[model samples]
Target: MCVADGGVKTDRLSPAMVDKLTFLRGVGKQFWDLTDARIVNRNITMLRLGTLLLLCGSVFANELTINKIEDAAKAGQFTNIKIGNIQVPAGQTLHLKGLKAGTKIDFVGKVTFGFKQWEGPLIKIEGKGITVTGSPGHVIDCDGKRWWDGKGGNGGTTKPKFFAARLTDSSISNLNVKNLPVHGFSINSCQKLAITGVNIDVSSGDYANGAHNTDGFDVGSSSDIQIKNCNVKNQDDCLAINSGKNILFQGNTCSGGHGISIGSVGARKDNVVQGVIIKDNVVMKSTNGIRVKTVLNAVGSVSDVTFENIKLVDISKVGITVQGNYLNGGPKGEPTGGVPIRDLTIKNVYGNVLPKGTNILVWVKNASNWKFAFRTLWEVKDKIWRRTIKQDSDAQWRGPGQCFADHPQPRATRFTFP
Candidate 1:
């Protein structure tokens, strides 16, 4: 019965398994004190104490129920196999790689993950203070219409990218991911991670639009990340901060997709996306509203960003896209003054767009100390605003009929466009 740091070595429990682990540790201390008790059923008492710790076995070990897929890939690392569920066996990959530190995974009903063509993630949650959860209409389903067929991940068929969480000080919440044959959640190198109320529904890939590149949370090189109250309807970027440092996207709700991004940030020389905080959030029929792509020559440096109280809708093209000649997916050629955006702050952002969208599009080659206080009340409809960097009519009313048109100029050695 040696259960200390080295954990699990069970043998002694048979007094009715020690009275069911003393009534399951008093119902796990009222389910860990209902995690701060807002109490609207607290996820139905955490799914009835995770189905009574999966039918009485997990006081802290032996509850595993991985129905194959190589016994859930050899039960990850097994630090006392506390409480795993994972019901694999439709098409195949349910990896769950190294998990150990304080493990607690769930999902018993609708956990299908078996489609294949290759290059998949299918489901791979690495460890470190892990705690993955699900069961409120439980769904991990990645049938993705048997792999969309619309050139996602480049050219069709090999669709498998479902969920690849590289958690650190983890906490994934009430998840309900769907139709993800392509990108969905690839949060990497997480530290103090807390993704809440997760719900990435690929709106049926918008029907004939065929869900190509379905990204919902592509954070990378994470730090104290906290993606809150999430709910994304994907097609592309709903939250893509490709490098991190104190990131926090709050009260989320993005639709259609290609909103809330912080870079195709410098392709990687230790890519640095600094203290970001996209607050309040809610972007609807998005195409681009709150973006910051930087990739041309690629190096690094996206600093202190803050987009506050944002709420855009129907933005069909550009509501706020800062560019550095991003490639492949738009912004064709010439504008690489090497990733240097600093101290940007856009506030009180309200929204609208669709009469040929384009509320603000700053083509950055380099920026510094920018502050836009979009004083609410906006209903953009081609209120065209473009910046190559030469703003001084007090930054031209800040937006909504904010005029500026001499684009493509910021490179006379950085700062001389007009």
Candidate 2:
């Protein structure tokens, strides 16, 4: 209840949002409140101070359409939440939890659920300074093909888990998710979270009952997390920081998954993945472009990670995959650093893979500064760097450039730059 001018302030709300603000339909007293109130412009967007608020009163009742949501997880009894055209109910959960710390949820139409098979998140949104958004031709359609049975979440039909962001100091913007039956945004236990322009479209699960383990952004134990400029087309791991710390996966754009990762990171309980920053992204036709799996023989530790200026297209399997031996379900030969990958950083990760792909595949074991993160210091001469490091002529390579290939394992190193 915030009118602020000559009236309204209900002690920080919650008498059921002060009886829903006494049905505030006062068309134009022009006292719309959410802090620093002042507006006539209809194209609203105050992203931080009161976030995506559209508490209509004039401009043709700006917007307030909530169409039956059985008390959408009782969004702290409202401060503004417009959703419209909802469906939700098949092992339900559109639960937008305890808001009111500055709540302002918006979505502006078309959201659906209702496909059974339980264990879903379907959509869970915890709170503490919240502001989830989407308006602008919104569409959070997780009709994931009625449980795309190509086995996601590791099984035959128990698919569920579409969004469960338990936030803190939150902010989620421009969400436009579509078709993802397994995982899409599970940013766990967040703190200062900031996700922008999200667009996780499982490109229709990419054909024939596909889109396995969906996974496009699955951050765990989140700390000051910031996932920026998103756009993911998934299959699995298009941004997966299994444990976090000052995390920031920036300027994103991933395609056909398994691209930006960090931790297959042992069993849980905050498996130690400190300060990560995967910057200036773009990993197209993916399958691995700067991955960092750390598991087998589990135990924790992955420090100060950084993979800057990414960008890799056509990557079909490996274009910088730093593994510490995942396990049982892939990569388990003999890596027992039991985690220890400190001060890691792989810079200027340029493109091209898929000639059986494999250009930098360090099979970890105590990786510190992992080869100075590939010594990126190019001046560019030396015959154009020996024709770009001999264009991968089956890299039985060395370093300082005559790089890539022939490490077959045991501290594996397969390079490729430019």
Candidate 3:
């Protein structure tokens, strides 16, 4: 029995259901009065009455169950819907678009997407004022082994991207995603969206390095977004902010991937990532810990960014990197100073790096008003810090207690050259 905006629909209830309820109430009072006279008779009558009341209450419960993806697509603006376990066929996508305001979707079981070798998004969700939540063990299996060939989106078979979300005032929480072929979540054009407790497990790709560009969350053109309490084990960036404002990423654990990042920004003139807060996160055994990369020839800016209370352990390469000459997945071209980074703050970022790991690498052409409070806690075998341009550029280095400290020592030899 389900209740919608219209009315209750129950096969057992007759047209005089209201009258029946009134009569049941009168009978319940009589049973109470009879309790003083015949105790056993009143007790049996009360038990039967309680069972009928329970059934009546269920008739008005507000929840709908959907067993198929098509059923969800055709459902008309339900306030609460439960999605049952189902397998999405190959070469097809499961899309839930244009959900009504205040709608809540609950996932009770796993959803397995069939394997395919196409440029596709296996799941797409778009709506306003919606919330999609899952139970503790709910999973979305992408079956990526059918497309893994040691090359991800770079070459080999063209695999589908896992999920795409375009939402406003919405949230997605407590979902476990696994075996993505290429990238994970693509969040675009969303406002006030909160994503929490999501787990992306692509650890199998580490065997022989089969997964290439399997990023965790690729955020673009969004604002007031919060991504928190998530765990990701992939091959690429755990969270990449391409363009956004007022974004907060906190309390996330990342491993076996490129760590949290901001850009590859400045590809377009409108590409800008500002007012971001990345705090209380852990990165372990990743290629890079925290990075901000801007394309050399592009035009834009990255400003007002804060990284606080972050812990990096066993970082394979550079722990902290800020570069302006980024291109084709690496920093190789001449930095043109087109994209200026300003008002950056790094606080309480303590970490340990592997042997031959560089701690801090900065090659920006124009930067200003930056503060670094990396006391002496950061441990690395190679250089503690290195910068391409000489001369102080208005940036300040402070100790653990905000005391003025000397600049970090330079590397013995530069690693990359333009």
TM for every model, in the order presented, reads: 0.34, 0.33, 0.78
TM-score of model 1 vs. true structure: 0.34
Please say which candidate is ahead in lDDT: 1 or 2: 2
lDDT of 2 at 321: 69
Using lDDT, rank the candidates from best to worst. Answer: 3, 2, 1
Residue-by-residue lDDT tens digits, candidate 1, 1-418: 2111223333553333455555665665556576666655867677766766664554545446565567676665564332234555555667776766787776534667654588767777788898887754557767687778667888858777778888889888978888887898888877888989999898887777477888888888889989899899988888889898998989999998788888788767568999989999899888877888888878888888889888887777777778776876777555565777778878877666565555666755556666666333322222222353222222343332333443332222111111
Model 1 Cα RMSD, Å? 17.4
Q: Output the number of the TM-score-best candidate.
A: 3
Residue 257, model 1, lDDT: 74
Q: Model 2, which residues run further than 4 Å from truth? A: 1-63, 66-81, 87-105, 108-110, 113-139, 146-171, 174-209, 212-233, 236-256, 261-286, 289-316, 319-371, 374-418
Q: Which one wins by TM-score: 1 or 3? A: 3
List candidate 3 segments past 4 Å from native: 1-62, 374-418
lDDT for 361 (candidate 3) = 62
Write out the backbone clash pairs for model 3.
none
Q: Write one digit per residue (lDDT tens) for candidate 3, span 1-418.
A: 2112124344454323444455555555565576665456866767756755665565434456667667767544566666668888787778777677887777766788776678889888788998988865567888787888878888899999988889899999988899889999999899999999999999988878488789999999999999999999999999999899999999999999999999988886458999999999999999888998888888888899999888988887777888777886677644666777877888877666565566666766667667676332322112122252112232333222221124443333122111
Question: Candidate 2 — what's its lDDT?
Answer: 0.72
- lDDT scores for all predictions? 0.71, 0.72, 0.76
Model 2: per-residue lDDT, tens digit, 1-80? 23333377777643434554554434223333443556545444333213212442322132245666686755577767
In candidate 2, the residue pairs with backbone N, CA or C atoms under 3 Å apart (3 or more residues apart, or in different chains) clash, namely 360-414, 404-415
Native-to-model Cα distance after best TM-score fit, residue 112 in candidate 1, in Å? 13
